[model samples]
Target chain A: MDVRTRNNVVVTGREDGPALLLAHGFGCDQNLWRLVTPILAERFRVVLFDYVGSGRSDLTAWRPQRYSRLDGYAEDVLEICRALDLRDVVFVGHSVSAMVGVLATIAEPDRFAKLVLVTPSPRYVDDGDYRGGFSQADIDELLESLESNYLGWSAAMAPVIMGNPDRPELGRELQNAFCRTDPAIARVFARTTFLADNRADLPKVPVPTLAIECAQDVIAPPEVGRYVCDQIPGCRLVTLDATGHCPQLSAPEATAEAIAGFVES
Target chain B: MSGLEQDAEDLYENAPCGYVSTLPDGTIIRINGTLLTWLGYTRDDLVGRRRFADLLTVGGRIYHETHYAPLLAMQGSISGIALELRAADGAKLPVLVSSTVKDTKVIRTVVFDARDRRTYEQELLRARRQAERLAGTLQQTLLPPSLADVPGLRIASHYHPASTDQVGGDFYDLFPLADDRWAFFLGDVSGKGAAAAVVTSLTRYTMRASAVHNPDPVAVLRDLNAVLNREYAGADRRFATVLTGLLVPDGDGFAVTMATGGHPPALLISADGSAEYQHIPGGQLVGPLRDAHFASIDLRLRPGDTLLLYTDGLTEARTAHGRYNEQALREYVLTRELTTAPALVEELTRLLAGFGEGLDDDTALLALSVPPA
Candidate 1:
């Protein structure tokens, strides 16, 4: 398989510098790193790409059996590193991609030099003796909401009077294009993400790691981040004052500064 | 404050859908009466007391924080998001919400009461699931209950459905004919669901009826082809690929005469630890054509020799290594020291299970072998 086309890989920055691979999370694509990529690009060869089922990657490569588990995504990461001949690379992952990076790094520790995780959660559902925050019922409702949302989007194809009329085109674009994921792929991805249990895989990281937890994050709470830090050996935990799940988007400067400090040190 | 015909109070208080304005963190700031009434809440109960996420069920809250909130933060607006709200009295209220961030601070949400819509969708889902169950049950009645055990042969068969929701076209049966002779056939129809099921039931009964009159494998298929062509040779014409065989006890084994109608070649494993495909070349698809010809091959099944007939679903199943084509199947069987029919069928069942999601089609396997006496 052509790794570049399959993953929609975009490589920039100086060729002589070390490589920084950025993996996006569930909702958006590689564009999630739009704010942080420029800052990192000045010092490193920035690599940004989308998972096969998301963004502009080749959707035909999505096979349910292959992508049923997180290992398939890890294989993509390893394959990307192999294709670019990237050695001792710094891997930066957001949301569920953090766990994806953990799996990849564990599989081949020599390839990744440093790890940066943004709002990462090893498990979403609360198990015994662990507060992963959400429950199994909540994940099921999330799936139901996705189905209902997909139904609304598809059923309202013939332009209805829903949102503001002043910026009708913006409303239309939101209904038609923005954050548009294939309903089937999105459902499977949601199940794979929210239902996954990677707590056991967290302690296996062999490289220096950084866990950035956002304040008041409803998805990955601060406690989950601390748990990740405590499990992994010699890992540093940084809690951002930025609210919401995405610190990279809400407060890119601080997020980039935190990442820059880790990479430089 | 404006004296215009469409005043701010008129729009906010009596909009078609429920409107709620909240802080960036989903804390309720100002809400409309329509939303308050739908949730059985007073103004003081929600306005400053609760965030928007707090009103949702455990699941909806997670979806709101993870998917909805993130999208609103990134894109500044999200439309037509379906979520369930927990009412004041613990009832579930399904709502379609559209929210937008104003100046990257306040969040203005428009919620549509989707109780009726949700009910209709649920009904549709229920009806679809019911239809799938009915189709599945009907599909089961088309095949034989059990393969009758012949004195000289050890036989076993398996049917694997890629999906339990819809009925597939693959089928197999092994039954007694007359005078200590046994008849067995495995075939796959062209389509799926109820229509294909009708064709399958007809083909099975017709093969049995035709075989009783004329026990020749080729003649039996010819008769079935004639019946199917006469019945369904119209616009919605259905066809089938069948491999029918008649097994008659010879000495310590059986002589098998099998005919193929565009079906996959059967595998013959010899007692000498070798396997080869019994390819029948000039066979045409049964039904859809008036004169579909079939050819029969005669093979002597010696002691410790096994013969396996199957549908194309086995050979055409997609695998990580590529399609499990005839050559791959031949290589797999050639490598295995297959002695009994049951063992070979069990191994093939495991191989099919290994395909997982790649095996999108239904498969039917029927094996007949002479045990080493």
Candidate 2:
């Protein structure tokens, strides 16, 4: 399989500048980084991609045996990096993507220069003292009859999904998904992300890392951010004055600036 | 429209549906009486105090932040999203929501009660599953538990249902007639589900009863055609492509005499594995027509020779370029050198699996061979 086509890899910005590969979290695709991409692209070579089961990436390539684990998603990240031959890269991951980035960086430490984890949680369900912010029941509720049915994903999103103005060919592309999400795939991804235990993998990070948290995030609270920073050696923490799990969407400018500051430093 | 326009404020505040307006970031900015009454929340409690997402249940909140919010920003509108909200008393209220971006900073939304609809949908889903289960059970009862053990011939059969949820139209059976003669038949009904299952049941039984009455292949098919025509001769008449045959041990091999009613011909593989289709020219469809012509072919299955009978589902399955025609199946059988009955059926079953989604129709295959004795 063509790795670039399988992941829907989109490369933009200065070719000579350092590479910054952005990976999105669950419940979305590569479109999650659209708001912040333009800002980060000015000085860095940016890469954006959708996970196999999410967004416009080929749904045919997704299998429950492969994508039912975070390791499967981590493989997607590593494959994209290898496909582009990207080296000394700045990796930015949002929500669950942060854990995915951590696994990828651990697998191929030489490919990455810096790791920027945006509103990430190594584990979502609460364990004893380590609060992942959600109960086991809450994750179950999200998985049960997951709400986003791509066939029923509303006619309003058609224009954006059919032929996005920014890239008209995306509509013509196979499995064209801008914002629409398949519920079956979403359920698997949700299970993989929420039930994962990547806290053990955090301490093994081999690069400069930044854990950016939101001031008031229900998904990943400030303490979880602090815990992430304290776990990884020499990792920095920054909390943007933003709410919601997705800072890239809720607070794009601050999210972009924080990422740029870390990447350029 | 004019009357409603005259009382626009009253209608907006007290319409059958709840209407609210929120900021681009989902902060509740405006609310109406009906919605406040539904949630038992005052303007002071919701507006400027909580965002639209904050009012939703935990799962709904996650769905909103991840999917609803991003799509709304990208598309400027969203519709008919099912979610639940916590009423002031903490009871969950199921609702269908549609929101449109009224301006750069404002998103107007309408929320409709979906309590009854959700219950109905769940009931429908449960009932559908039950029906499918019953159909599967009924389908199994229509086929023989195992192909009857003919003393001199080796036999294997495979059945594939396109979907597990609904009963398919394809069926096959093999049994013995009196006087050391064995009877076998394979056929496909036009439609699927419980209705086609009825036809399948009738066809299987009718073929059995007809063959017992007269083991002659053409006579048996003619009797079936007459029974089907007499029973289902209405405007929306049903039809079936049936193949019935009798096997007789002929000293060193089995003499196979089979008749077809608008069905694909059986493929005969010689001992050396040269495969070709048996031509049954001008076999008319069963049912509808008062009198339908049946075609018969007589062949001998010598040592190491096999005969394969299948429904159109096999020949009509789609390939990347077009339908998988009979010629392809012949070439596949010849190249693979499939001469044994069990080997032919098993390999063909594997081929059917390769069709995947393209195999939309049910398929039935029955292979019989005279092994070296």
Candidate 3:
């Protein structure tokens, strides 16, 4: 498979400079990195891609069983690396992809140099004394809401999501085009994102990592951020003065600066 | 000012839809009186004290941050997002909200009450689920749970349902006849749902009754065609395609006599590993015409030979290579070198599954073979 087309891989920025793989998380596509790319592009080569079932990525390549777990997403990241033959790469991941990056680096340690986890969470639902912020019931309620949202908005075309990528011209006419996702595939991604328990895998990360948490994010709270930073050896922490789960969109310049600073340092 | 028109302040405060303006960080800087009344909150209680997301339920908050907020940021505006907000008494208020950025990305959001829409959608979903369940049960009743085990022959059959909400029009059955001969028929009705099922059930019983009386392949099809044409001759003319046959026991094999009425050609796999389709010429459809010519063909299924009958769903499947038509199926049968009836049925069943989203219709398969001597 041509991983570029499969993952909708887009490469930009200084070509000769070091490569930075920016992986967007659940809910949005690689367009989430639009604001940050211009800043990061000045010094580093920026690479953006949508996960297989998200955005312009080939939806036909998506298989439920393979993508139900985080391992499947990690394979997509690793495959893109091999396809581009990228080495000593700086892997930047957001939301659930932060854990995906950890898994990817652990699989191919020699290929990646550093890791930057944005609004990262190793787990969303709490277990034992762990303060993952939300409970199992909360996650269940979220899933139910997600289901209803699909029915309300995209239910008409939900049945035809397979093998049908929205035309580029059609995306131009729709206001919510960038976040256009197949409802069923998005549900699987949400299940994989919100219910995943990657706390055990954090310490397994090999390279120096930067845990960029938001000072006020309900999805990935300060506790989860500190937990991830504390777990991984040589992992540092940076809490942005931001709200919500996506700092790149909320505070684009600040986000870009942090990414560039970390990569250069 | 005229008595017919209201001032801007009155219009903004008492509009049908709720409007709230927020700062870049979602602080509720301005809210209309209509929304304030709906949520049972006063201006002092909400403005500058809460963010737009704070008024939402926890799940809605997650959705807002994950989907709604990012979309608004990327697109400069987002509309018709379904979310629930918590009222003062903790009752959930379902609403559809549209937001756009203006003046340094301060969010301007409009919320519409969606109680009736949500209720209607839930009812529609419930009705859909009930219809799917009914279709599933009805389809099960149409098919025989187990084929009758005939002596000296291996018989395997499989039914692949293309949808859960609507029953397929295709059906098949195998049963006994006089003199210990077995009679079997496969047919595809041209309609769907209960109407098609009625025609399908009628065709199956008529074929069986006709064969029991005459036991001739051509006669059975002719009777079915006449019965359907007579019963549904008006505006709702229902038609069907069938391949009905009788299996007469021969020396170490079965002499299969079959007739086709516009149905797809059935493939015959010989004992020597060769495969070919049975083409009975001049066979028209089973219904609609005043008089249709039905043709019959005879085949001797020797030991280790198999005969496969399937609906057009198999041939019409869209695959990676191309449309999986009859030629592809025949090539698949020959090249795969499948030896027995059960094995071929199982492999074809797997093939149907491999078609995945490409298989667009309900399919039925029936394979019969004489045990290897």
Chain B TM-score by candidate, in order shown: 0.76, 0.71, 0.78
Off by over 4 Å in 3: A1-4, A13-17, A38-46, A147-153, A156-176, B1-6, B146-164, B173-186, B207-220, B243-259, B266-280, B295-373
TM-score of 3: 0.81
TM-score of each: 0.71, 0.74, 0.81
For model 1 chain A, the run of ten residues with the poorest summed lDDT: A152-161
Greater-TM-score candidate between 1 and 3: 3
Report the C-alpha lDDT of model 3 over B64-145, residue by residue, as the tens digit.
8887888788767766667888999999889888888996778999999989978987898889889999998998888888
Per-residue lDDT tens digits for candidate 1, residues B1-373, read 4556557787888777899999866679999988888889999999887889888876677666655776677678777666788999999888888888888589999999888878887788788779878877877798778889898788899999868777889988888888989888899998887788888889999998988888999998899899999999678898899999999889888988999999998999999988889998899999977988899989999999999898888899998788889889878888878899999998898788667567899999999889986
Q: For model 2, how does the per-residue alpha-carbon lDDT over B1-373 read when each residue is reduced to its tens digit?
A: 7764788889899899999998756678899999899999999999998889878887877777777777677667666677788889988888878888865758899999989977876687688778878877887887788889999788999999988788889989899999999999998998988888888888888888989999998888888889888878786588899888889989899888989898888998999758878988978899867778888889898998998999988999998879999999998898887768999998888788768678889999999998855
lDDT of 3 at B101: 96
Which window of 10 residues has the lowest lDDT sum in candidate 2 chain B? B71-80
Interface CA root-mean-square deviation for model 3: 5.6
**Every model's DockQ:** 0.19, 0.26, 0.33
Which tens-of-lDDT digit does each residue in A1-265 have in candidate 3?
Answer: 5999989999999999999999999887898999999889888889999998888887767889989999999999999999999999999999999999999999999999999999999889999989998999989988887776632335332212121234433433352347667778888998899899999998899998998988888788999999999999998899899888999999898888888888889
Candidate 1 stretches with Cα past 4 Å from truth are A1-13, A26-31, A48-76, A123-130, A135-204, B1-5, B22-29, B40-51, B72-77, B88-90, B101-107, B143-196, B209-215, B229-293, B297-373
